[model samples]
Target chain A: MTDTADLEALRREVRSFLAAEAPTGWRDASRTQDDFVRTQRDWFGKLVRAGYAIPHWPAEYPGGGRSLAEQKVIYEELAGADCPRLLLSFVSTYHAFATLHECGNAEQKARYLPKILEGETWCQGFSEPGAGSDLAAIKTRAELKGDVYVINGQKVWSTMAQFADKCLLLARTSSDGVKQAGITYLLMDMKAPGVTVRPIHQIQGDEEFAEIFLDNVEIPVSERVGEEGKGWAVAQATLASERGLTLMELSYRMRGALGRVAKLIREHGHEEDRGVLRDFGTLVTQVDAVCAIADQFLDNRINGIERMGDASIVKNAYSRALRAYSALGLRLGGMDEQYVAPITFGDLNTGNWMADFMNSYAWTIAGGSEEVQRNIIAERMLDMPREPKGWVL
Target chain B: MGAVIELNELTDAAQKAFPADKLSPSRDESWQLAAEMGWLMVRLPEEDGGLGFTREASTALHLEMGRVLAAMPLIPAQLGLQAVIASEDFAERADWLERLAGGEYAPLPMLSAKLTQGSDGSISGTISGVFEADMAVAVVAQLPGGYALVPLDAPGVSLVERPIWDPSRRLFDVVLESYTPTLMLTDASGAKALHDRLSGEAQLALAADCIGAAGAALDMTIEYMKVRRQFDRPIALFQALKHRAADMKTRIVVAEALLWKRVRDESASVTELAAAKVLAAEAFRFVTEEMVQLHGGIGLTDEHPCHLFLKRALLNLQLCGNADLWNERVGREALA
Candidate 1:
């Protein structure tokens, strides 16, 4: 357990640092995708230099070896400061870092870890068009030709892949036995020959995600994360890396953005409307509960008491609150929201109610979907019987 | 860590006292057991000659009691005791405390009291939502003069059994026709303070109860889904129903998290506590609605205990202020 005094001191330290260095009006300045990427890189670099970026890493890395409580403090302050999320380096800091540090050999860690600190961004290549929620069913193929393996596949829904320098690629090594058994994890250079990156134009007009096409992209076998047919296990490490912290951060950010809703109510003269106030009040409590649950989830993780479906509960709560938050804003905004407005890049509550509402779908549809989370909660947490797979009536 | 351990111990003891196999166990027996366990004084300070346990301990007890649908009026009993404990002006505070700890029931009304003060200083109207009033020695109520301890046997005061849908406990109205106030707990300002404190406590207790019952309801529904076969297989094999069950579990877990967090936070406002209650009640509502539907026709019959949970959820929503009142207050406060 973490000492209260120690956590409070760390919180004060982070708050003072943020007061001096946190970016202001970054959302307004990030009018273009390139601008958003630039702002994100600058913030990530500052955090890395300040020793506040990779608190979950080992003591060997700067700003590392912090307790989960300390990490939570840092995230809370960052969210409170409304700092631009370290979006561009999200994969590099979490997914790639976890995969390399946990599953990669010493040589691979030495090669990639330092560059990540130097602002080399990474994106995941796990989800393909054919996979989505059933990630193990990915069809991307890799074949060995001497020391290099030829990779050919297309990956979608890879966040910020267009700006990434490296890719955490998963591909089929063989078609033997189970679909997951034949898979292998490899690191690919996004700028390598026969690789193409295309940004996805989302419904909210934010190109926050991108697609990657790999055609005969050859990579040395040394780039493999683990033994052949062990990528599924390694991918779990990557997926689990961002679980507690990101949601905690986002929940706090959403709580802070309640002011945006409040402002809308005031502007629309609905502050005196009991119906609108009730809706807003309901949303406020929902968001607060999400924050509370997210905090509890991390506390449980810190205490080694986390259960199978705890993360799913936090994710679902956060996403549902987010949807409710935006839907209320859209309703309160009325006719003005229906008219198109410039959307803030990478911000969930941008005051563009229509875009914000549309952007809320990203949470429900992505990251294993709401339905999949429900399955995990029902079967894993509540001990409900899992439906037999491949049941045909 | 000590607090969490205390909570677990209390929860285990409660489960042992009121097992799930016996739904709505004999109220008088459970109430006596609770008194013997010193649960009534769980939150009263040690200086006050009580257990001096933290809020988490009481919350744990409430949750376990809710799980089994225990028939004891523990929530109102505790709240009523807290009212006496919080009062400095009441001369018989210690005597009242001793009697309460000795298993003499005196519950505060869970709903608002519709009363008016006459020019002659007498009070009239009904104090609704008195749980198990037939067993109560007195009712802690808010009057025009302030908060007063009104003995049920006093002149012009009587208990009217209201006959509620929830069979897990009894509800009654304490009708006061020109009832003279006795045992003044607090004056106007002091009464306001105690009212705020008890309302906060009431929210936490109700929230814990909802969370506990919601968990049991989800478990019962899931258990039924696993065994009740349809279409030549257990209904749990259906993804649609399984997903709904998952949602119920999620809502319950999240609300429980909030409830536990708020219970430990001493500085939480009344509105914040009410918000926790609203979340719990809503989750309970969601779970019980699914509970009945998932159980199919058997859920609608009196043979099953599903309706008990559903009825309790609906009643809990109407207690300590309904979802509408608290939600509007929450919104109003957040605006500022």
Candidate 2:
């Protein structure tokens, strides 16, 4: 509930900070996965020192405790300045921080929270090959062996796990109850014995996510986030940690990237083509609407008026718009896009239309697939009756 | 905060006046009720002898009207009143405001006028898209000279009802055969500014209407899905149908967010405003289309309210420049 004047002041402060310290040409600098990670790390470090990186953190921590409004301002400035998004440290500062801050023991919190600011990156180990949108169906197994939790599982779709120092692992400790009830959340070290990190080569030729295999990886019992078999609730916090801001930032970036489509229009001599203009116009409006919805979602959260399935709507809208944006670019880019231009890693709207179109699938498929989001909207928000459970094929 | 509270109060009052159950309530009664409620003057400044509420107030009122699929022509009437209020140079501005506030209907045309300025300084053409002109004392038209009040009873002026698919309201073509402009609101030099202002307002108002009606349409579809059953269970339980409904809701919410954002932003360009309207109207069309499909066979009947919503959504898309026109303009602007 920041007042307009204070919000404007914060915006100005962020704008000035971005002007001074924001990385330029980082997209071009991020040609390889390693280069992308480097650019991401450098920008995250700069933002951390300038007190704009982790505004959602508590006041006791530097660059923390900013309101949602303030966080929005920072993200908006970062996106507007075309700065590199803090992709490498995202899970550390958000998911890890949230899980530790909200549900961790004091020792765990003190151990991890400070390290996060010091550039210790983390990745999620919740999704499995068989789990995905049905995350609770994960078959990762963990058993208590004295003071240590012996873990054995294969976790896929863990973003940046290949480079992560720690993994927020969700494993099945008890299979006697519902799928979600048996799960346990543990902070496992990525460097533990028999822990294998294999980066998943994405369709766009980037390894933004990886698969982690644990063959007798031992995590101390103290690393558990909550009571055994109660990890589902704790996982909710980690999932909900970063909301509104990311989508808002992405949507704004897409809106700004409309210039790419304009350039295509000009390059192809489609300026007088009514059909192309109409399609571009439709895409522009869709992107604008996505931005609006993202902004409104944040405003609702700030005002505490957010309702069930609000986040789902924002996600679906943003993903659909992202698809439309890239598709339009791909269409206009035509034979040129098919010739394989080098893609800028870790960015959705990199002006490389083919790669962008392929990367857009990440948004729709990851972070709760579009279909899953629709179910949430219908079953929860619209009060539609759910299907009978325990149906066998 | 005050504006928000007032908007809420206005919405509540409107819903109470035109309950959702009654679709296409008698147009005459609704118009009278709206005028008596001071809705026609919602945007008139206090100094102009009318309610000095902001555009949000009228937008709120329009949304409420849209929810019930009200038959009244409030959108154009409000635009007309705004046009008169903006003409501070017009000698009879005060008189026109008083007359309009007192329920003398003067509506701004939603479509362009095809006119040829006569050699004798008279204009002859047909101004189309004047909603409910049969009830209007005059139509506020943009002649070649400028924006002027074309009195319905004046010589060479005639109204021809142009039957539209949307039965909730009437549309007419205001034909002028060598008609002289007596009530000039703005000269040719000032017309573009006034046109831009009115167009922006029209976009917001229409956007609000689309959002409101789209919400209602979605609610109706959901209600039908829940009650209507198939395959030994309620269809609402089916993922296929439920997902469609969810997409419908998403479109409505997203377009609505854009509408309110543009409505609150004073510096939004005309193209930006049109972009908002285009999104909202498209959403409305999408929702209504889904509404009919989701409702099944009953939706095809003339007696059902689904057709009403569908027709209105379709018409709203065409109003204030169709999606193609606005989208091209939006594309051009973004390119520039």
Candidate 3:
């Protein structure tokens, strides 16, 4: 754990770095998907060169070896400075890096970990057309052929897959035993022959996620992570890579963006409206509580006192608060918000209330759906009995 | 970390003193026990011949008391004791602190006082929300002139017990009839400072109480759900019921996290502290509401303890300003 003095010093150092290099007008620059990708890449490269990115990586890698506390400091500074979040490179630096560091062979790690720092982006191909919340029931087929695996599957909701250079592909290698038993995790080149990536047009007019179609896409056996049919365990490592930090950062960002609500209240001349004030006040407290819970969750993890379903609680609270924040803004923005406006590419609280309200759904629906998280909280944390599985319809 | 360990030790001692099974224990007995435990001076400085524990220590103690729905007036007693401690200018400050720390009760009222100062330096009106004033030697109140300790035995000073819905504690109105103030704590100008300080403390203490009580309420509900069977199975196995329990748990944990966060922050505003309390009290209300419904017909009965939690939650919501009052203030502050 970093001491208080050292943490303050690090905060100062980060503040200085951010003051010098934080991107301004990036939101305006990121009106289009390609421009958004360019802005994200530029900011990420700057962070990497300054040794601020990948703080969770091991000490062998540059800009790595930071404790969770230090990582928290960095993220707080990043979010506080209003810098564009590294949205495009998120899966590459977190999910890919985690899978390689934890489960990949030495050759795979050596080949991929360094490339991630050098701007090789990755996307997850875990959820299939049929498998969304029940991810293990994927029907994607991967058959072993000589020294290569021919993959044929359709992956939906893969975040920014169209822009990724590689894919963390999960496909079924066997139909034997349980549904989870046959899944295999492979690192496949996104540009491989027969691989197709089509961006999903979101309701908010942003293509933040994509649908990847794999038709006999060949991946060498060397690219497999862990043993065949044991990908679920390795997938756990990838899923658990970044805990608490993202939500905590987003919560703080939302807290900072409360000014947008205040601005709306002022601009709409609701300053003297007690009903509006009360609503704003309630929303403010909700957002503040979310920030508090997120911070506490990270602190617990840092202190090794995190319990099961704690992350789920944080996620649910944050998503709910995000909904409340955007809904309030949308209500106040009225007909103005309904007007079609150019959406901000990679932000949740952009004052574009309609887009933000639509974007808030991603939090409740992705990572784990709200219902799935509720189950985790109930069955795991609360010790409630789980429903009997495998019941026929 | 040391403070955390100290808080745990305090919590353990509180649990040992007041077990979870004993709901609404005898107020007189609990008050005596709390006094003997030196809890009244948990926040008093060491130089003042009291235990020099931080606000966290008191918060922890209050949480334990809340868990069993203890009927003791610890919150008001602690606030009154703090009022004495804050009065460095009072001539009898040390004597009052010794008396308060030594088991003599002088409770700060939970509600406001409606008083008018007579031309002859006397005050008359009613000080409301003084919990267990029948047992108090005096009541610390905000007089029109300033803050003072009005002795219960003083002529024209009387106690009128106001029965409240929350049976866990007693409430009273300390009615005054042109009673002359003898023990002055603060003058008019200094009153706001002390009020802000004590209000912040009261909010945190109430928040801790809400969190602990909400936790117990949730636990009790879950226990009942585990035993109450429906559709040939325990209701806990039902996903719909389980989801509600999960949501209840989420509200409690999230509110509690905010409570502890604000409690640890030395610079938190009174409004911020109130926000924490508001979230926590609402969480308690939510949990108890679910607790009753989840328990079905049994929860609605007077014999069951579910209503006890519900009553306490409702009362706590109105204490130190209700949600609407605080929420509006919070919004106004943020707007400013």
Candidate 4:
């Protein structure tokens, strides 16, 4: 029976902190904006010093004591302020740290949790070239040798492997049943022998993803979270956190997109045109609908009665909203803005618009494609008879 | 989520409650079963010889009728009766509904649907498209000249069956040169109120029927895909086909949501009901069309239920109002 007034005060305190900490000169900063890494690291450090980072973890764990409500406020503040935490804080704020909060053993928490909170470093080694959506299909084998297991596998799309000091690796421990039963979740040192990271050029001209090859990488068996062949279950737990935490970022993008469109239309001088008005009206309706659903999703989570399947609805709705907003931006730009070559800022703003448009394709594909989401929704929520599993994994 | 409308009888009793033999496959026996059940008087009060139902209850009944593709003229009949009762003009017709519910005064007991009170103390509207016009015992003709309860058998009155797409429904075109009067009222608010009340009723009927049809249409498509083989496998196994079926399910789900919203939302009214009709009709047409396309050539035939659904789609599309118009008006209603 927490008091509403108390929650409001905590929320206000977070928001007030956000207003103070919002980096100067950060307004719609593009993906390739210079000084991003340095700026992000600096921002992450300041928040850590302020004891505001790792807000979801309890205070006793060398983390800020905050309820889910307070944790959401922090996410909202960071997103609303347009603070860059995606690649920078994902491992600390989302992956490894999230795993520690959820499934970490007592000793594991005391060790890996502290490094993540101060943003010292961590990286995910979940996806392999052989395993993407079919995560359990990963063939990264970790064999027990003495007190340690030697790991050998390739991981792709390791977002920040260039700077990450450690890799939260998932490796196969047995080849029984399906690929899932033979895996284990482990915290591995990135600097270990036979681990190599190579950046991949993205469509957006940034190396946001990488290909990591592991050749007999050796790590203590103690790094494993649970039994050797239980990786798939732990991986599922970690992946669940990805969906639960990132929704606020989607909302922020949607709001900013909505705002930009309003500004774009007004600038384009079609504010009063019938077609444009209708489009605006429709967009407004959709935005309201999305916001309502998002609010409801949050309420359900807070009430401790939420459906995991509904996360798909939010992902689908949010991506589509972002796409809708981006499409509208392109339309407003017309031939001059759309069907033209990109230029630097002030030359043509579609570069930013185009960047966002390109970025949204990954929203669906990144955290399990919308098609996979449909399967989850159908099987779990609607209780549809399972389609014979189509994938080899 | 339809308003907790505890009806006196069944909810889907609109047309389905009528024995299938009497109301469907051309409704030749409506005179015996439909009229006998007091389907027309479902919305009327017991004081007025109806079963004493709420507006939501009555609307729900008609909706259920549409869902089953029932061919009873409940909307027009009960609407006309409501007017008669409200105007205190039911002195002679008072026993009509009692007999209706008792399975008497049926076979072809029709009161009127087409008479508009006229000016110059004369009623003159042609009242075309009168449902069950030929079967009417009399035409409730209202005009500027006067209000007349003229028997359909009267020489001056004409009831020509207007070839309707819904073979089950008998829409009539009435031509009256100058009909004799039954009773005229200087004020017609009673009739107007009934008209107003019936608009909501028609909306609910169209929406609910569309909901039922949409469900049926999706079922048909899913079943068709399950066995229809292409590329050496059932088409339903194809991801492309599966996604289309999934989209249809989404629309039906939305339509169902809107149907409940129309009946339950505090804002539920004429406009909300109309929106439901539009959503359901569009969904019905979309699903039915996909059903046919999936069936290849067989779906376009008269033998298939697809055409019937298509007919209802086209009919419902134009009925109440078109979807775009309704969607636009919903926003306007909010603004107002």
DockQ leader: 2
**Clash count, predicted structure 4:** 24
lDDT of each residue in B1-336, candidate 2, tens digit only: 898999899988999999988878999999899988888777888887778998789889888888988888899999999899989899999899999999988999998889999889998989999999999999999999899998999999999999999988899999999999999999999999999999999999899999999999999999998889888888898899999999999999998888888888999998899899888899999999989998999999998999999999999999889999999998888898
- Could you give the TM-score of chain B for each candidate, in order? 0.98, 0.99, 0.99, 0.78
- Cα deviation in Å at residue A309, candidate 2? 0.7
Candidates 1 onward: DockQ, in order: 0.84, 0.88, 0.82, 0.09
| Candidate number achieving the greatest lDDT relative to the actual structure | 3
The 10-residue segment with the lowest total lDDT in model 2 chain B: B40-49
- The sequence of per-residue lDDT tens digits that candidate 1 reaches over residues A1-393 is 679999999999999999999999998989898889889888998999999999988989988999888898899899989998888888999999999999999999999998999999999998999999999989999999999999988999999999999999999998888788988999999999989999999888999888999999999999999998899999999998885999999999999999999999999888789999999999999998998999999988888989999998898999999999999999988999888888888888888999999999998989989889988987888787776676578
**lDDT at A199, model 2:** 92
RMSD of each: 1.3, 1.2, 0.9, 7.6
Per-residue alpha-carbon lDDT of model 3 for B87-197, expressed as tens digits? Answer: 999999988888999999999998888899888988889999999898999999999878899999999899999999998989999999989998889999999999999
The ten-residue window of minimal lDDT in model 1 chain A covers: A383-392
**Residue A186 displacement in candidate 1 (angstroms):** 0.8
Interface RMSD of each: 1.0, 0.6, 0.6, 4.3
Q: What's model 3's lDDT at B306?
A: 94
**Quality class of the docking in candidate 2, CAPRI style:** high
Ranking by TM-score: 3, 2, 1, 4
- Position A308, candidate 1: lDDT: 95
In candidate 1, stretches whose alpha carbon ends up further than 4 angstroms from where it belongs are A390-393
Q: Please, what are the lDDT tens digits per residue for candidate 4 over residues B172-257?
A: 66666555555443145554544444566566666677776666667666777777887887766666666666656655654555
Task: Please tell me which model should have the higher DockQ, number 1 or number 2.
Answer: 2
Question: In CAPRI terms, where does candidate 4 land?
Answer: incorrect
